[model samples]
Every structure is written in structure tokens, then in C-alpha cells.
Target chain A: MTTLLVVLLLAIGVYCVAVLEAWIASGRFRLMAPACSAIALLGRESIVPRKPDLLFFEMGPIVLLVAALLAAAVIPLSPDLIITDLATGALFLNAALAYVLVALIMAGWGPNGAYAMIGGWRFLGQLIAYAMLVVMPITAVAMRAESLATTDIVISQSGLWNIFYQPLGFVLFFIAAMGLAFLPPFDLPTAKGELAGGVEAEYSGVRLAVFRLGRMVLVVTLAAATVTFYLGGWQGPSLPPWLWSAIKILLVTAAMLLIGRYVPRIREAHLLAWCWKFGIPLALLNIFIVGILLVVIP
Target chain B: MITAQAIFIGFFGVAAVWFGVVVFRTFSMVRSAIALLFSQTALGAMFLTMQAEFLGVLQIMMMATEMSIMAFFMVMFMMDPGGMGKMEMTHQKRLSWIVGLASFVGAVAIAVFIDWGPVATTVAETAEQTEALGLELLGRSMLIFEMAGVTILTAMIAATSVAIPPMPSPEKTHKDKV
Candidate 1:
């Protein structure tokens, strides 16, 4: 039951994201455009490149979809509405999503094209750049909560959202999440202008549909995570818990999608340097602040 | 519930072993790396079945990212990364068989011979276990985790420095021209 609800919510969130993206790209709001596009994609055939790695080509999209779903499983939409509710739910989400790297590398390598291969390798570099930015902020969050449970993290933000409490960590986490999703400015993996769609170059048909869906799911999941971590998740009054979760997730998704349109994509080298040098230190500082706050204020 | 736990443990253990075998059997370096990932993932699941939530999740999380880097390095070094050219994964068939059989027999004999202690049935709840783990990490074993973190950071810095070629000095260009 929880699985069905989360999937449905994720689907809606993805649709909303596509709508927002289309609106941002063009001025018109076409609600049905994404649905039409998905149907069109399903009708096309996924053409395999000659001498391609067959297993990787087949497994990439499926693994991506599974990874996103696995991530969504641990994220609590409401107090009682969580799936599994693992002790290490926060860490589990990170664990489940790590497969995103493997999936992309496989997808990139599967086609055996130069563009795809470069794009795949680019994400590996991106992984090196962003992995700490992702993990470190979560450490600050887990510190404040004194637990790794997603629900506990959310509850810790009840009196004051992590965004307000540790805005530095929130900012770092949000930026890292954007990079992870590879949204426009960070969309080096599938940048259309430079690498001719990069990793998406060789993918087509139903396979392409799955790949695209997987990406959308990823973006939405990251946004949901941002909300659950930074924003007071499901805590606003007048709305039911699930409704608050949905609204917060969608808003975060919109913000994440729209924010990328303004900034230029980060260079791979600069990303690695900045993340390790700037992001990690600030993350440590955030932890220190949170630690002091716990002691001094308590 | 006990039956289900046993079933999951058995399933993941078998899967882990099967994938471990698949790692050796595959001709492709990429496939072998991915097979190792699956083997590691199954082992993680086995940890979960034993109720070590943190260990299980950490194992899965760490292995997934590590394996991709492994895949990258393996493919970079291999002669046929795409597996188009069939290459032998193993050498010295008779010696390999003898070693493999001996290891299996030795493992089985140890398992059977050891006077294993009484089974621990009651397990700590996940939250308590997680809290205790947090305490252990932040309390008793703080230095170890910190050292691990610094070592990884050092490795990252070393890898980046190696990967990025140094900029050529202007003096070198002038000397070459002269």
C-alpha cells in the first residue's frame, strides 16, 4: 500500500516537473505534452549499436528505475506512511542512490559511442566531485537529529527546519542534490548541445522512455530528499501530513528544475576542486555549529 | 517470521555465492566487475537478515560506488574492455581446480569442526542498534572513523593531482624556443 502511494506520488511529481520545465523552456503551459512525448517514446524502437555491450544496454535503464524506487522506499512521506522504515533510512537512501553512478556508467558504456562514453566518464568525475557534498551535509543533519532515521531527521526540523537551523548545510545539500540530478546547469551527462545528448545519444524507444523516466524519478527523489532534510517535512498546519509532503516535494522539485536554467554548467575540474576544498570544509563547520548549538542551547 | 528470516538469509547467501562464481566465469572485465557488485550486494542483504541494519546499508552503499571506480580502472587497464575479444580469465586449470577444491574443503571442515557457541536469538531493535552504533562511532571508535575519513580524503587529493596534468611553465616554452 505504501509502495503504491509513493509510486503514484512520484509519478505525479515527475509529471509536474516536466510541466514546469516545459513552461520554463517555452511560455506555454501544456499539461499533456509530457504524456504525448512518453507515448511517442514507447512507440520507437531502441536501436542497439553494432558490437555494443548487450547486457549493460538492457540493464542500465532497469537498474536506474530500480535504484530510484529503492531510494523512495525509505523516505517517509508521513509519520506512519513510510515503507520499511529502516534504522539507517537516511544512509539507506544514500546507499540505494549510489547505484545511479553504476547505472549511468553502464548506460554510457553500453552504447560504445564516443559521446556516450565521454558522458559516462564525466559522471564518474561528477561522482568524485559531489559524493562528499551529498554525504557531509547529511552528516550534519544526522548530527542535529542524533539519529539516521529519515523520520527523526524530519522531526528534528519541527521546531526549526534544518534550512533555518543550519542554512549552510541546506544550501550545500541543495546544490549537491542538483548536481546529482544533473539538472540543466549540471547536466553534463546528457547535455544536448555539446555531446549530442551525451549519454542519451544512443538510447531510443521504450528503453529511452525508461531512461528518461528514471531521470525524472531521480530529480523528484532528490527534491523529496531536500525537503525531508531541509524543509520541515509534513509539518505545516491546515493540511494533512501526506498532502504537506506532496506539496513540499513538488515545490522543491520545481525550484530545483527552474534554478538550473539560470546557471551555466560547472566545468568538471572546477567541480572536483570546489567540492573538496569549499564544500567539505563548510560541511565540517556546519557539523561544528550544530554540535555547539546542541551543547550551548540545551 | 523466523522461517522468512532464514529464507532471506539463505537466498541472499546463495545469490552472493552464485554471483561470486559468475565473477570468475565471465570473460568481460565489465561483467566481472558488475558480478562482484552483485556478490557484494547479496552479502549486504545477508547482513540485513542478521539485523545489522547499519552494517548492511553501509556495505551496500559503499560497495556500489566503489565497484564503479573498480569498473572504471579495470576497463582502463584491460586490453578488451568491451569483451569483443574472448580472453581467458583463469590460467593453470589443474592447479586452479586443486586450489579451489582445497579451499572449499578446508572452509567446510573448519565450519563443521569448530565448537560454535549458542545462537543469539534476540536481537536489538533497529533504532537502539543505530543509536548504539552512533555512540560507538562518536564515542569509543572516534579516532578510527576520523582516520578512515582522512585517508579517503588523502587518496582523493592524490588521485586528482595525478589525473590532472600540471600546466607547462612559460620559462620552459622560452627555453625550448632559444
Candidate 2:
């Protein structure tokens, strides 16, 4: 029952984000009726470029969606309420998200176009920039938790969230998360005006729709991860644990959208430079600070 | 219990059929490439199910990124002028058949004979594991390794800038005879 609920919640969350993006694009919020109609409109004909591989285009979205779902399954929503509480949950989550790059590459290669190829290269560059920063912060948090289990990470935060103790690490992680989600300032690969939807430009019809849905789900999963790592997943006063988690996730997702709107997009190379220079240093400093505090305070 | 097993079984069954169709499909090179791309993606998803999250993520990222680049190259350079005959891999008589059978037999032999070792117990499962891992990574041994990563990244930026095309030298106009 709990698994079903979590899946349902995830579906609803992804659907809501999709509707919101469309609404923002079209300037309308007519509730359910218009949202359903808009969703149906997304199914319109997709232009397949000549000599393109239909099988490859079709599978890109499926791979993304399945991976995201499987990753989410391992993340505990509350105590005693996980779908598959694996011993190596953190490693599993990292592995699942890593496949996003593969799917993007496939979509690019299958299309047989110059723009897609460039976009794929750009995406690879972004991955190199952000992966280390993201990993470092998570490592810091994991170190503080002193356990690999997601539940334990939450439990360890009974007194204080990781964000409070490791502010710099949290900031670095948040930035990396935004980049991974292709949100705003870090969204250079699909810089629509520049790359014309980047690697996804050639994809259309149901294939495009699936990719769009996958992106939305990926955003929510990232938000859920931030909650799990920093905000103390399902930990709050008064409200039920699951409800608390949902509320926290919603707030984080909202923050992501806001960042999308306000953050000015940086050039791809410039972003990579910033990550290697500023991001990596800050993350290392954060680890150092945490180490000292753990020794001195304890 | 039944539902969970059913979901799992259904996923595997679908994956098998999907993969088979991709392998048999006679399509343009672009199409075959795309199908191969998706197959890698499906394997990544399978990795997630096996509780190897990090590996799964890496697979998806690597495959998708590489396939996109491959597709882009095909579109940009492989087209015949006026779009007449698209490039495709023709069926080579009997060659693929031997390679496919040999691989299948090898895989079956390995599956039947391979012996797995027992899982080892580790002290890292306790409460201090995270702290210990962090301390170790930040410790002197890993410090140099981490520093090296940053240094290499810096060198990459330097190299890229140096490789950018320089402006062409101006043509020398005929002035007064030297």
C-alpha cells in the first residue's frame, strides 16, 4: 500500500510539474480541463528527420523513466515505508541518475544531426563539471551520517539538518543539483535560443512527450534527494512524517523553479570553469570544516 | 506479493521482447544506432533493479551522451548529396551468424559454470562508517589525489584555449619595391 502511494505521489508530482511548465509556456491555468487538453495537445505529430532511427528515439524516454522510477523505489519516504530498502541505497541512487547522460547521448546519436551531436558534447562537459561537486557534498553528508542507509541519514539528523552544519556543502550540492536537472543558469545544453532545444530538438510526438515527462520526474527526484539529504526526510513537528516529506519536497521543487526563472544562464565553458575552480574548492573546504567541528564539538 | 512479482516479471518479459525486436529490425543505420542506444539505456535500468544505483546512473549518462554525439555525426556528415541512398549496414552472408552463435554458446557456458563467492562482512555498516569514509577521503592520502583532479581540470581549460583557431594573417599588399 505504501509503495503504491509513493508511486502515485511521484506520478502526480511529475504530472503537476509538466502541466505547470506547459501552463507557463502557454500562459494559462484553467485547472484540470485545460491541463488535460494541453496534455493531449502534446501528442501532436513529431517530425522524424530523414534516415533517423525510430527505435532509438522511442527507447530514450523509456530508459529515463524506468531508471528514475527504480531509483525512487530505494529512497525511503518514512521509517518502515520504503519499497526496496537496499543496503547500498546511496550508491544505487547515484548509479540510476548517471544513466541520464547515456539516454541523452543516445537521443543525440540516433537523430544523426550536427546540433544533436554538439548538444551531446555539451551535456558530457556539464556532467564532468558537476558530478564531482555533487559527489563531494553527498560524501560529506554520508560521512556525517556515518551510515550508507537513507533511513539512518535521516535518523542522524534528529538534532540538526546537514544543511545547518555543512552550509557550504549544502550550497555546493544545491548548485550541482540544479545543473544536473538542467535548470536555469546551468541549462546550456538545451539553451533553446542557441541550440534549438539542444539534444532534444529533433525528437517529436510521443517520444518527445516521454522525454518531457522524464525531465519532470528527474526534477522531482532531485528535489526528493535534497530533502532526503539536507532537510531531514520526513522529519518535522506536528504533521505526519509522509506529509512532512511531501511538504518539504514541494518547497524544494518550488525553489528549483524559482532558480530556473531568476538565475542568468552562463556559457557552457564558463560554467565548467566555475565548477572546477569555485565549486570544488568550496566543497573541499566544507569537508575540512565538518571534520574539525566533528572532532572539537564531540 | 503476487503483484510485486508480476510487476518484476512483466518488466523483464517486456525488456526481452523489446531487445529482440531491436536486434532483428532492418532499418537505416541511423535507426539501428538509435535502437542500440536505447538497449544500453534498458541495461542501465536493469542495473538499478539490481541495487547498483551509481552504476546505473553512470550507464545512462555515458550511453545517452555518446549516442547523441554519434547521431549528430551521422546527420551532419553521412548524408548523400540530394538525399538519395541513406548509409546502412548490409547483411553480410554467414559472417554474423557464426559470431552470434559463438557468443551465445560462450555466454551459456559461463552462466552454467561460474561460481560466486560469499559476501564479506564489513565494519563500515556501523554508525561511524560515514565519518570514517569522510575522514579517510580528507586525510593526507586522498588529499593529493583530489588536488591532482583539480590540477588536471585547470590544464584542460588551458589546452582548450590554446587550441582555439587563431585569426588569419593579413595578405601583404604590394607596397613600394624593397
The prediction achieving the highest TM-score against the true structure is 1
TM-score of chain A of each: 0.97, 0.93
Give per-residue CA lDDT, model 2, range A82-198, as digits (tens).
Answer: 887765566567666766766666676557677875776687679767877777887788778766678878888889998898888888888888888787677776778888888
Kindly list the per-residue Cα lDDT of model 2 for residues B64-152, writing each as its tens digit: 54664464455456553212363354488488889988998999799878885664433343225434555777785597779889999
Candidate 2, residue A245: the lDDT equals: 83
Candidate with top DockQ is: 1
List, residue by residue over A210-288, the lDDT tens digit for candidate 1. Answer: 9988988988888889989999888899989989999999888878877877887777778878887888899889889
lDDT of 1 by residue, B1-178 (tens): 5688999999999999999999888878888898999999999999988999889999999998888888899889988877777876667999989999999999999999999999788889988987787789999999999999999999999999999989889999899999
Model 1 CAPRI rating:
medium
Candidate 2 chain A, run of 10 with poorest lDDT: A29-38
Best by lDDT: 1
Q: Mark the regions of model 1 whose C-alpha exceeds 4 Å error after superposition.
A: B138-178
Badly placed stretches (over 4 Å) of model 2 are A19-29, B1-178
Candidate 1 lDDT score relative to the true structure: 0.87
